[model samples]
Target: MRHQEGLALVAAAATGIQVGAAMVATRFVVHDIGPASLAFLRYAIAVLCLVPPLLMSARVRFATRDLLVVMALGIVQFGVLIALLNLSLQFILSTRAALLFATFPLMTMIIAACLGREHLTGAKVAGVALTVVGVGAALGERLVTESGTGEWLGAILVLAAALCGALCSVLYRPYLARYPTLPVGTWAMLASVVALAAPAGMEGLFTETSRLDPSGWLIVLLIGLSSGIGYVLWLWALKHTTPTRVTVFLSLSPITAALLGVALLGEPFTPGVLLGLGGVVAGLWLATRTPVASSDNDV
Candidate 1:
C-alpha cells in the first residue's frame, strides 16, 4: 500500500510536467489551428494511441450506467476543458496560461470539499491561497496589463477550463475506483472524440491537417501521444490518492512551463518567477501535509 501511494505521487508529479509541456506545444500549434480543431485532432490521435494497451486490458468492463457517467466526464475534459484552454493560449503566453492553470489545485480543493470527497482544512485552504498569490506574483505584468484588454477573456476561459477539469476529476473518483485507469482513460477519450467530432468537422479541421508541413505533423503526433500517456497516469494517480493531493503536485507545472518556455520559446526568466517558484513549492508542501485521521486516499 505504501509503495502504491509513492508510485501514485510520482505519477501525479509527472502528469503535471507532461501537461505543462503540452501547453507549451499548444502555443506553437494553435496559431495555425482553431481550438476546436486542435482539441479534436489532439484527442483523436490520443484515442488512437490508447487503443493497443486497451486491447490488452480488454477484460475489464463497466455497467452501462457507470460507463455513461464516465463518458460524459470525458466530453467535459476533452471537449470543453481543452478546447477553452487552447483558445486561451491564442491570446496569452504559455507561461501566463500555465500560471492561470496552476490554480487547478484550489479549484479541486473547493469542489472536493463541496462534494464531501475531502475535508476542508485551514492548511489546505492557506496552501491553495498562497499558491494563487504566488502565481499572480510570478505573472507580474501579464496579470495586470492584460486584464483590461482582451486578455481578460483568455484568463476567464482558462479559469473555466480549470474548473471543468476539477469537477471532472472529483466526479470521476467513483468510476476510477471501480475500473482500471487505462481502460477508463481510453473510454473517456474515445467519448471525447465522438463528442468533439461535430465542432471539429464544422471547422474543417481535417483540411488543416493536410496543409501542415512534416514538422507540424510531428508536433501534433507528439502532443497527442503525450496526452494519451499523461491522462492515463492522471487517472491512475486518482485511483490511489486524494484529488487535492494529486492536484497540489500540479504546482510544478507552471515551474516546468516557465523553464521550457525560456529554453524553447526564448521567454524571459525573472526574479518574480523565482520567488513564485518558492511559494508554489512551499504551498504544495503545506497543502499535502496529511491529516492524521482523514480519508483523502481513494482506496
Candidate 2:
C-alpha cells in the first residue's frame, strides 16, 4: 500500500481541534436557545459557508445513487448527531456532554471492525482509550461536579450521538473519496436541513427564531462557519486514511478546548492540561504507527 496517510491523520486532528473549539463556543449560546433551533441555525449557516467553495470551483458530478447515499448519511451526521448532542446538553453541562461524547472512537473502532472496513489493532484500541482517559483528565472537575438535570440521561444521549457520528464517519468515507470535498460536504449538510426542520419547528424554534439578539446571531454564525470548515477537513482526512485513525483524533478536541480557553478566555494552564496533552500525543503516536503490512511503509 502506498503510504502518505500521515497527512490524513494530521487533517483529522485539525478537524478535531476545530470542532473542539466549536464545542466550547456552543456552551455559551446553547442555553440561550433551544437545542433543535441551535442545530437548525448551525447547519443553515453551514450551508451558506459552502457557497463560495461550491461556486468558485469546477463542478464535480456524482452518480444519482451515490448522491442519495450522501444525503442519507448527512441526515445522520448533521441531523441525528447534533440533535442527540443538543438534547443531551439540555440536561447536562457542555463539558460533561463533551467528555461522554469523546467515546466516539470506541464506537467507531467497533463498527469499522464489525463491518470489515478495518482490522482491530491493539495499538489503535489503546490509542482510543488513552485519548478518552486524557479527555477525562482534562475535564475531570467539570465532569464530576456537574449534577445537572438528567445528567445520566444526557450522558446516554451524547453516547447515542457518538454512535451515530461513528457510523456516519465510517459510512461517508467512500463517498468523500469519490466526490469533491466542497460539494460532498455541502450537499450532505443541505440534506440535513430537511431533517432538522421538523424537530426545530416542533421545539417552537420558528416562533423563537425572531427573539435572538445580535450577539446570539453572531454566536450562531460562528458555530455554523466552524461546522462548515470542520466538515471539509474531516472529509478530507477520511478520504486519505482508515476510519479508526480518523476517529482517534477526536480525543484532541477536549485538549483543544482547554488550550483555547487559555488563549481566548484568559484561563490558566494547569498540571492536568500537561498530563492530558501527554496522553493525546502518546495516543496519536500509537494510532498512527505503521502496521507490519501497512502499505505506507512498503518501500
Instruction: Evaluate all candidate structures by whole-model CA lDDT and list the values in order.
Output: 0.82, 0.82
lDDT of each residue in 110-162, candidate 1, tens digit only: 98888778888898888878877776666666655654345778889999999
At residue 152, candidate 2 shows an lDDT of 82
Weakest ten-residue segment in model 2 by summed lDDT: 290-299
Cα TM-score per model: 0.92, 0.92
Q: Which residues of candidate 2, in runs, are more than 4 Å off?
A: 1-4, 263-268, 291-299
Residue 220 of candidate 1: its Cα lDDT?
84
Please state the error at residue 7 of candidate 1 in Å: 1.6
Worst 10 residues of 1 by lDDT: 290-299
